[model samples]
Target chain A: MNKGLLIVLSGPSGVGKGTVCSVLRSKMPNLTYSVSATTRPPRQGEVDGVNYFFKTREQFQEMIARDALLEHAEYVDNYYGTPRDFVDRTLASGKDIILEIEVQGALKVKEKFPQGVFIFLMPPSLDELKQRITGRGTEEQHVIDHRMSVAAEEISLIRYYDYAVVNDEIDAACKRIESIIIAEHCRKDRFMSELADMLPASEKV
Target chain B: MNKGLLIVLSGPSGVGKGTVCSVLRSKMPNLTYSVSATTRPPRQGEVDGVNYFFKTREQFQEMIARDALLEHAEYVDNYYGTPRDFVDRTLASGKDIILEIEVQGALKVKEKFPQGVFIFLMPPSLDELKQRITGRGTEEQHVIDHRMSVAAEEISLIRYYDYAVVNDEIDAACKRIESIIIAEHCRKDRFMSELADMLPASEKV
Candidate 1:
């Protein structure tokens, strides 16, 4: 079986990446959402190995030292990371896996998994981004302003991404992501090996 | 308006590129087939501008000398070429254009239009290719052998293409092409400028 694609979706904090990813999961049943490992305590209703692989500080640090995490970043004094072996096994099983991550973590992941389809989920407009952040109404004005600035910086790094989908509408964004997956499968570099077998031995290049 | 894509489809003669392209045109109404200029006499029911921009020998020679053809080739004592102005005008007008050409002509077109999406259509297998060509029953043994050798050589050149589509079924090939187009639109380089406008002036890169 052909190895499945590793789709990495990332964007600024308040760009609706989560909502788009959640909707995309239901549409693509074959897709497996990668469960991240974190040192942060699980919230109520969050399950270990399902929502996250909750780890102690020492365990997280050991994983980092052992180079077992694909990428790791500290947030609010808590460590979060992807397990390198989990992603490898999923892909080796020919199951498509998706990682919805922060822009920094996505870039970090790319360092090791350069083959992953790195997609930047872009906001429709700055005004829209600001409104989305404000609409959350969970944070103070200072927190919102900080996020907006971080979003702006993260968006400027889109040049490093393979594809950019404007999150103007969640469904539309999901559809475009689906098309990208289909198109990536058609890319010559990825599909060339299959065609190589078709070429007659004498004519093979 | 975003500049439309220049899609170039080519394959061995018996690989069903024409049939797939025709079906694709019906599905994608905005896609315009680039009408070629030819020195071959208009066949019965063939229109001048719609079917081909029919040209005389002297006119074809003048066009070649003037570099007015995007790509040209001589076949069966007849000259067939793509008009540079026509393709450029159509693309400038923001209409996606498709070109169905031979492998050699497609490569020539790429030398000038490297931005074009080059797709190499493939037969499912050598047996399938032989059957398709033999089914026509219009050639002698020598002609059939010559065509098969040529097809084998053309298949090897797939390394130069951006996508290698197996024309195992016409509709499947068309759908893959549609996905490629959608994915191309999402490519970071093509869509980045649009995102630039959304960035705050201070954050523009």
Candidate 2:
């Protein structure tokens, strides 16, 4: 079986990455979503390995020491990270996995897995990003302003990505990402064996 | 408007490259099929600049001297090559162009345009290739054998390509090629200015 691809998706806040991912999951049922490991306690109805690989701080630190995480960060006195083993096993089993991370973490993951297809999601415009943040209606004006500024910074990092998908319409964005995944599968590097098989068996290519 | 991609499609003999190109043209009306310049006299009904850019031996040699052809070779006392001017103008006008060439010529074009998406069309299997070649009913056994050996040699050069698409079914192969073109547009290299635009004007990214 062919090995699966590791897709790293990152975007500025309020760029609709989550919504696009949800639609993508519905479209492709076999796609594996990376569940992060965190030291924070799970809320109600969350399950271990399903919601996250909930770990103790000591355990999380041990994992960090062992270099078992693709990327990790400390937020609110708790540790959260992507475990490397699950990703490796899923890909080896021919199941594509997506990692939805922040820009810094995504860049860090790229340093470790340069083969991963890094994609940056973009809002239709800066105005749209502000509207989406305002549409949430939960954050204060100051918080919204802060988010817009941070989003601008994140957009600057898009050059580091392999592709930038504009999420103007949910279906169209999903289709573009889907096409990217299919195209990556057709990459020449992935078909070396198939090419070799086409050679004469006696030639010993 | 976004600049168009230069797509180079190559395959071994009897791999259905011509058939796929025909179907692809119908599906993608905006795509431009590159016209080649040749020193050979045109056959009856072949139109200049439509079928091929018919030129005299002196004219073709002059074009070569001026570095006007993307790639050229003398075949059976007739010069055949892809003209660079038409391709450049079409791409500059935001129209994607497809060049259907042999393996050696495809590699030669790669040297001139490294950004071009090089795709290798492949038969589902060697058995399928033989069946297709024999189905033509025009070539003799020795000719078919020679074609198969040449195909094996061409397949060995697939590593030089950017992508390999299996032509199991014409429609599916065309769809894969279409997806590849769409995905290439999303490449970061092609969207640098768009990425810069996504930043806030005050940010000076």
In the range A127-199, model 1's lDDT, one tens digit per residue, is 8989988997898999988988888988988988999998888888998998888888878888767767877
Runs with alpha carbons beyond 4 Å of true place in candidate 2: A201-205, B39-46, B200-205
Q: DockQ scores for all the models shown?
A: 0.76, 0.57
Query: Least accurate stretch of 10 residues (summed lDDT) in model 1 chain A?
Result: A191-200
- Give lDDT per model, in order: 0.90, 0.92
Candidate 2 local accuracy as lDDT? Answer: 0.92
A123-195 in candidate 2: lDDT tens per residue? 8899999999999899999999999999888888887899989899999998888889889989989988766
| TM-score (all chains, Cα) for each model | 0.94, 0.91
- RMSD to the true structure for each prediction, in A, is 1.8, 2.5
**What is the C-alpha interface RMSD of model 2?**
2.1
